[model samples]
Target: MAKNNGDGKLHVAMLPWLAFGHLIPYLELAKLMATKGHKISFISTPKNIHRLPPIPKTLTPFINFIKIDLPKVKDLPENAESTKDLPFNKVKYLKIANDGLQKPIQDFLKTSSPNWIIYDFATYWLGSLASELGIRTAFFSVFPAVMLGFLGPPNVLIHGDPDNNDNDNTIIIKRPKWVSFETQVRPSLYQLTRWGHYNSDGENMSDVYRLGATVDGCDAVFVRSSFEFEPDWLNLVKRLYKKPVIPVGFLPSTSDTKDDDININNNDSSWLVTKQWLDKQEKGSVVYIAFGSEAKPSQYELTQLALGIELCGLPFYWVLIDQRGASDEEVIKLPIGFEERMCGRGVVCREWAPQFKILSHDSVGGLLIHSGMSSVIQGFQLGKPLVLLPFSAEQDLNATYLVEKKLACMVPRDVDGSFEPESLADSLSLVIVKEEGNMYRDKAKEMMSLFGNRDIQDQCLDELLHFLSTSIK
Candidate 1:
């Protein structure tokens, strides 16, 4: 049998996917558990674990990071960080991850075992195996509660038909009997851009199969959201999963600032400097534009964004990631003299930036984003107004939910699937100078307050510990 820490403090293990979006939140949860006197073992591949900044020696007393070697796979991309970066599909990634988990985790359990494991979506394959070994498992879904509500019920995932074939239009909304079209649609706007995957037929089949396989034989499924946000959906999910379905809110109760000097190799430090710059600017004067790591716009959209920022005439910071159209041999080729004209007025980081710190900066009045949930949650948490530009995947749904719900404004993606300079500028103007902008900013603040104030973390921690204690006993 797996052994506990022996202090009545739950011994918790964490296993997240390779993606930054997945890794950051799970790490935050691990930090929270460690603060609650729980012993933690954060498991990841050596490449991934080494990417983390070192926690100060002071916080080292509570947590341990366990690194295991990734199995040898041929023709894998060099410097592959997460499953997202792999050349294969999500299904393929899960299969390999499941194979990888069996041996290392089994060996870990045979040695120093954890009472409970707070695992990510990709780790679902290990559920039955973990249970067989006498360790309890809980699933931590990084997506919103509503997505969980939709995906949680095995029937909806298995039996339901998508609303449309267009990845942009496949919005199959299941509202609470109490919510009206307006309120439900309102809440759905911010979610639309993020849930873009539901719009595509390809995603529907793959996601359904993957989620069903993952949720099977798991102990509990916890969503990172709140009851107030979607009480009816949460109830629906509970009925469907027939397991403990809980919403743990956005932020945890406590976070230990470990890894003070941990540097993400390709991440840029200019963002921190921008934070200082924003601190000096007038409140709400600057706009922050960032498409998450996956978005790779064609050369046309790149020019359009540049033109839009130029037309908006706002002091802005645009941190670009994974802009793949340009090769290593060719530098970023801007419109003629675009840099000279916009010099000092704009900043673009081809590398990753410190997003949370930038959003929290006082001068950052608004954000232009691809509606990734992590970015959306953080943006909302910081009370910054948003202009959503959803690409593919869940981002389209998230953006839709935020905008349709009046939490943000949508800068509709281009025909080729990008944001144009004109629409981009219009959206920016509406949010910053238009009457609608004022409303969005105010509503964003309200949402931020709700997310920040809800003691979701404490509730989650308490429930997780309870489950661990019961299982170990």
Candidate 2:
């Protein structure tokens, strides 16, 4: 059994990658630890920190937001601190800037000297830093454990494919020789190539290299997954990494606070209009569409998507972000007369929408979204079936997993990984209107037995806390 300190309090420092997908889970863990009487220092750049969800007032005292200055890079745009602020190619610059934080973070560690430092995969340097300060380090992965298992050990990932000559054909993904069971999570050759390119040669170290080092160096590893959902993969991760691989349960948003209360109190007109529109829709009739924060679709893709939604001929609420900065023309141009054709049945929101509230609404029966892990958890939590359109970075893997598990249906894409309007419409209809989708609906609801079990999740957290407490001594 693990032993807690005399006062049963531990000081922990959290460091997550700059993306919201990475940052949010780290914050959730910090909040969970805070509720257990731990003091946490959450570190990030200023702009990224400013964008985090509002921390509950009661827990504010125990959690400290520490800001580090982002180093200036020539190609990286000014004030672009997070992945959300940059286009796909420019993301490497953000990583370079993040690597520059080593000295500042090292300095902070020397002074604060926390018992344990919980970090994300990108910060491979953190393990050495924690060692120098006589503190323990734990790696908290926001991605699913199954995806990690498919990638296999770090040596295989970094050194296995050294020739780079495997680009001529589609590589079939299958169960590694080390693993016993077959996995459904497979990436196409194009997806793998893009991934390889992103993490390949860079001014600083590559992400793949960093991930290998972090896994080898950390004291323990924690993944945002559950045994009920992925027992085999969880077991394989421990065997592959040769470390304590802990599952921390899917971190769902605990805030049930209604946005209507705040909207009504503040007299916000736009939200009132949107909420009233949602109220009028028939139960389980509307499809909620959002492609996630980081995916920037081209104008042609956006136009095709609009047409596809129109062709589906269902009531839909779509959230599209405006990426054209200071331009006079619209960022996403819908097919001409689209609004006039489907005025009452469709609503488009260019600004931020309350995603949780919309997902929880009675009118929402299904989701049309990118295969983000966070979105997957939310949809599963609400028992909403998915029409998946994956864009980049582990999303294809997520889509494959959901489809194989019968929890969702994926939109068909071309050999080059591009989707057409017809295929998009067909996927939407299959999930929302066709009889074939019922199995997905049933399987998604069945997941509630595990995904909604608060007791199991609490037990997992307790085990994690115990590990943290004991690892210090």
Candidate 3:
């Protein structure tokens, strides 16, 4: 067994996928563990580590950042550490490069000999490799517990090779036979046909197999969710996996931030302008619209969104992101003369807006998002009702769960498999403005007590710490 510090404090290491959504939560969890007087070693590419948000002065002592260089691959872009830096077509090469970290990580295990290692799905090899050196491992999932339940057991993950084309869409389109309870979440036929092969272009091992290997080799599964929110799903995961399912809390990005920082030290120029505009609006009147960093709409869909927001006629603030390679001239194209026509009524800022501040503002009443888990958690913390347009299968699962809970309204898609401006307008009106939206608004407000409560968040972390302290190899 890996040795500990002998004070019930363990030395834990963290490794997550190369995406901001994954990295931020892993770092937050690290800070939480470090706060409990445990040691942390956060490993990532040098660039990704440098790009993370500034670490707090107090927690810096306990959190140690270990930067390693990823072995260069054939087509990977220069200094492309995170998903945000690369286009979709090039992401396959990035995965190839990510697999190259096995050697250095093996070296880390040999020298540091941490008591335990918490890892993401992508590093499937780490579990077995760490086990050889007598170290314990846990799978730190950023997805919801229900999704983990949906992925089913280790046998399905291992035996079901994503690259195997026995029955193209027939097998995956249907829900797993293992799911005994009545659940509404499943990957759509279109999503499965399009993105199903675990996004394998030429990679040897698919993402699903990676997840399976990670779970099979790990001692426990640490999910980023709460038992209070989804007890049925949590229980299902436990029964199916037949292993310890530890809910590591929602790990809200705003947990450690002081209340004063929201209003005082948040001096980003982009936020200052946004605050000024929001300050003038009536309380709970504006709609906040943003698709997280990774989920971007096609240009045609962007036009539809522009028209839809215009049709809704509600005062709105839109943050339009220009993808990594887009130049100034390639700014998101709205309908001709769209901004001029909607001046004073709506503003589209291409710059980064402070999302937490915007969602928490009294002037904001609702949020329109792509159902990304991190974004959903942030919005719920401030009790903002959601209008969901999920872009991926995982997002679809989250949207289904929220709709079942009566906390969100889904924008209907056309037979052509694309959403229309009219559907967008109607959905936004129903969730943010119309009289019928009050129920959703009320339910979202009720969730604030669960998502925003720090004591509950700390309690979850305490449970995690307790598990690690007691469960020795």
Candidate 4:
């Protein structure tokens, strides 16, 4: 076991992608590193920083937040500091805005001279700046190793442009030349050829470019995963990137269970009501449905999801937040009289609720989630079964990997990736009620030792810290 290296206190500057999914894990990692007595210069936009859960008092002294202004771009919405504020398609403008921070960030590095600067895929240009300043850099991937494996090496991501398909999208849909595993973990036909990679319109800031360049340039790569899971992919990334590939563990919350309330305000009425309703349900009976803060199902999908849960006929707690970032008047409308028909079998909250508290409750038998890494870990933390409804490519990757592991059941979608109510209903019932789903529940429970183990996570952190603490860095 790698012990925390207290002999050398290293400084690590963290800059994750502007999305909440990435930001939260990076912050969790910051907290873990801080516990080793290292200093952290955590950077993000002002609004995102304001929205993040409060840093614990004990770690406050070790972490310093650096907020940079997100430059105004032509198409970006007002106050759209993070991906949560805009639809995924409009996020191209946000990347253009993120690039505007290059100047200020460069200035900070020159002044602080941190031992190592860690960054996400969005900052493809960051490695050059770090190299010039004589500082080491690490590409701290907030994504899982399986997705990166499907992405292949740097050259494949860059030249195999989905639009400029070299072989009629055949190359993408098929498993890469490298992956030796015989599994159904590759991207879908639609994901590969049709609705391919996410890209920004204005500049050379397409996701393919950013991802390829970031991996190609970084000194090393660190994944937010564990050796116990995706072992092949974890080791494959080393051969693919030709760099030090280290698993940062599952990043289970190192904080105590009571600390879940830190993100919730004392006057939070939404949590209060949600908790009261959960108290009424039978233990291990309620399906907790939430697509996360950033993903808002379209009216059609929303209707399908809502009606699907209703069709499942199980007690459920659903937290509904429309990510359209619309005005209050444009509130999410469920199917006409949908709630009335449910007759109190389900509870829906339009406002924010403490997700951790709900997942930890006895009432939550299984989770209906977006398959984001953080949510997946949370479900695994409590040894609960999962019903996955993925919205993006990354989500697809996570969901597919979990399904391959027999720990989750992805809501079956059409070849075009659109899901119907019937499919959603059947998937939920199979996971939460049917005996066939017991394997998923049992597998999730078995994984609790590895995924929820903070000691294992701490040891992974120690190894990474040891590398950062070396004099050469």
- The residue-level lDDT of candidate 1 at 239 comes to 74
Model 4's TM-score against the true structure: 0.93
Pairs with backbone N, CA or C atoms under 3 Å apart (clashes), candidate 4: none
User: Candidate 2 on 348-433: residue-level lDDT in tens?
Assistant: 87766777788888888799998888888888887888998876647888888888877899988776666778888888888877
lDDT of each: 0.66, 0.79, 0.81, 0.81
Compared with the true structure, what per-residue lDDT tens digits does model 4 show for residues 1-473?
Answer: 11223556777899989988788888888988998889899999988887778777889999999999988888788998877677767777888899888999999999888888899999999999888888788899888999898888888776664444555655666666778887677656665543455453555467877888998888889999988888889888888898888899887765443233224243456667777888899988999888876777767778888888888889888878765564223445789898888767888776657778788898899999989888898889889999998876668788888888788999888887678788888998888889988998898899889888978988998898877776343
lDDT of 1 at 232: 59
TM-score of each: 0.82, 0.92, 0.93, 0.93
Q: In model 2, which runs have C-alpha deviations exceeding 4 angstroms?
A: 1-5, 162-169, 172-174, 196-201, 256-270, 322-332
Clashes (N, CA, C under 3 Å) per candidate: 43, 0, 0, 0
User: RMSD in angstroms, all models?
Assistant: 4.7, 3.4, 3.0, 3.4
Cα displacement (angstroms), candidate 4, residue 255, comes to 4.2
What is model 3's C-alpha RMSD? 3.0
Write candidate 1's Cα lDDT for 1-473 as tens digits. Answer: 56666577877888877665677677777766676778889888777787775554655787888987766544344455455354223324333544566788778866776777777766546687788778878888888755565444554454444443353333554453333223333224334443433333432234555566567667888787777666656776777688887666675222334122124674555656776677677778788888765554446667887898899988887776433322222234568888789777777766556666667678888988877776777777778888877654456556655665678888865344555687888989889767857898898899776666636657766876676677674
Which window of 10 residues has the lowest lDDT sum in candidate 3? Answer: 258-267
RMSD of 2: 3.4
Best of the two (2, 3) by TM-score: 3
Question: How much is the lDDT of residue 465 in candidate 1?
Answer: 63
